[model samples]
Target: MNSLYWGEGGRFGPFDEQEDGWPNAGQVMRYFREKSNLSAETFALLYSKELEKAGKQNKRGQVTATWILNMEKQNLIPLDMERRRIIARLLHIPPVLLGLATLEAVTIQSRKKKPMGTLQKVTIDLAKHQKSIRDALHIHRTSSAKNLMQDVERDIWTLKDIEAQVRGDLLYQIQELLLSNFLLATRIMKDQRNYPAAYRSANEAVRVARQTQDNDLIATALYTRGCIKAEWARRGTVFNGMFQLDTGKMKSAAKDFQGVLQLEQETSIHPQLAGFTRLQLSRALAMLKLGPRDAKVAQALTMVDDAADAIDADPVEDFYIRALITGTLTGLHAGGYHLGRSETLNAAGLPGQALAELNQVRQLRQGKTYSGDETRYQAWFDLLMSETYMNLGDYPEATARAKNALVTFHQIHSPRNMASIKDIQSRLALSSYGTSIDVKELNDMLQEWYKPE
Candidate 1:
């Protein structure tokens, strides 16, 4: 390792003294200087070499030991952003350690591979470095699920401290990053079946979104909150004991979905947002309408139909959109085909038909899914199929499908889904099938998993 590349390029490596988040520029200066074990004068020699190598002619000609001294004491400096970049490169640290986007973000922006909406030149310049920082740092929930959570969680908390120093559009950008982190954490908790924790994380996202007045962001946060509630009502063992399908948490989820729609009606939302919101609403409604004759089921089907007609009507051709394939599952067509139709079929006492439809959907998903949504999509589908088989009194198939879903959840370190399916595991334990070989192995695996490390 180079002398400059200390702390794993930031607060995460050795020299892990107690810092709140990634270091500010002054702190970076101090950490790297001390780690080099060089006098400020000698450090200035390296700083000068870096500036000269970059062909950067510093105002006041060159940096001196006193300049380094002033910076270490947190005094503001001129040409700060550029000089910081030069110093970061000198120290062989990640640009992020200086609260800047990674070098990759700059390269991506230079190529214009991604657009940043309609920002004028000044705003573009202001946002250019920040354009993809959040995405670069954020881990997909199913990817790196077992590890990285603690590091990312700490980064999310550290962002608020970063937020206080900026103002105007840049501040909004930081807030958006904060909101995104909160949403990502919300997803993690929800996947873990920590509904209360998920709800709290989601509400923080909502607060950040509303503060920014970005309507689409606000809608996403609200919709995510609805998802947490709906998932909890469906899978939370404690909540299942307290609330039936028609009312309680399911209805609460319905209300939040309705609120998103209401917001959409008041604004011009993205077509995809409308599609996702309606499809999720359909799930809540289908769950609420347990009886065959219930009108809500029909209403739920209507929403699904509308989403299919609109969101899935066009064959996707956008380059970026076309390129993002998540394993073997892709767009709204699968969500509508599986969650919408299969869920309604199950709720309407058509478990056989639902199982058939689900199998068909699985076939559709095999070896052909969008890269972004594949794991989550597959995991949820497996869990739903398990529930449907349980309804049909196929305990073996139910246990098998449940185990399959558990495997994905386990891969992602999701205890919530594990717990949700644990109930089915327990019910299976009460039957003659409990003595079956596969069931016994699953029981043992789950026991080992739940044990404290």
Candidate 2:
């Protein structure tokens, strides 16, 4: 089977096609409609009724089967804003797909209907406000700040109102704002350990981006969704005692990442974003827990290395990307030793050597400023240190590090890490004091925290 046609019926199939000579808007619309089992005349009738609801008088005067046919043939352009919107709604397609020029004309007409500042000015203000919220999230590692949450919520409401008044080219900008808000919401909810709400926000971001027909935004939305799914999977393991791989969620995330990579290849835009997508793809693969000797694990390691190289070569200098790639490389290298070499080292009683590998992870983070989810990396480092101390027969140090790890995990609301820390602490207590301690109480506490309020 051709790799190109692999998983053709999957959720990401729409994004798998080669880059060159992509179909135009009309071709895309026609293909989707036909695939939906709708006849041209049937679609035309529904579209005509939609136009009528938008105050387009006389279906025969505005549109007909012939007009629909011409539109599908790319011979007719729906330059009218009302008609464009109605057609988009009826066909369940983005108005931007109609054409950039058509979308720009619609944007200009929509701006004329606004009572306030110019479109450019309003767009700039919204972008700045969104950026401020994003910066706050990065600096604080949360959206829990009262004033900031209030501002973000207020901005969301304002965006909804603005969305109702804008379409076409400006619709992309509005969708970008919606994506930002929802992405932020997703992160905030995730930080709060509210997986369901995080997933909801991510889904909304994808929906909004789809309406803009912007592949970059759509890819970003997919990435956000994938991250949320992966987090949920991680939480499930931590809270539910399901140690087996969450294959379903990991597969879904891989599909999303693959879709992003396909889109990037097609568009040739945002090379750094593509690198990030590849990094994420590597993560999803790693989470499968394929044995270190497995071919898939080797492939995933290669992907991690290749992604880091690509990011290093990106002309656009992004500190966040640099930090992320560095941290990822460090983690992957540590994980390789933990999964493969550590077993042999432990068997040989050369635990100190294993400790050295884990210590390298900490050294890599020195003087680095991580832009996103810094707590996660910190908690991971603490966990690694705790394990290393345990291996070295320093039970007291191991217990202390485990307790410290628990604090960091608690701050991040990471149930899985907390559970792992509790287990480590229990082991250290038993080994050093000859007192067997049950972690059931700690596990129960985590269960309560996992419960939705």
Name the regions of candidate 1 deviating beyond 4 angstroms.
1-141, 144-146, 239-246, 310-337, 365-373, 430-437, 451-453
TM-score leader: 1
**Per-model TM-score on C-alpha atoms:** 0.61, 0.55
Candidate 2 residues lying further than 4 Å off, grouped into runs, are 1-124, 142-151, 237-244, 289-293, 315-358, 364-377, 384-398, 409-453
Instruction: Write model 2 residue lDDT over 114-179, tens digit each, in one string.
Output: 222211212124446556655745644431332355567777777777677654434455566776
The all-Cα superposition gives candidate 1 an RMSD in Å to the true structure of 15.5
RMSD of each: 15.5, 15.0
lDDT of 1 by residue, 229-327 (tens): 888787664432122333588888988889888987998555555677787888788777757778987888788667664445434544222211100
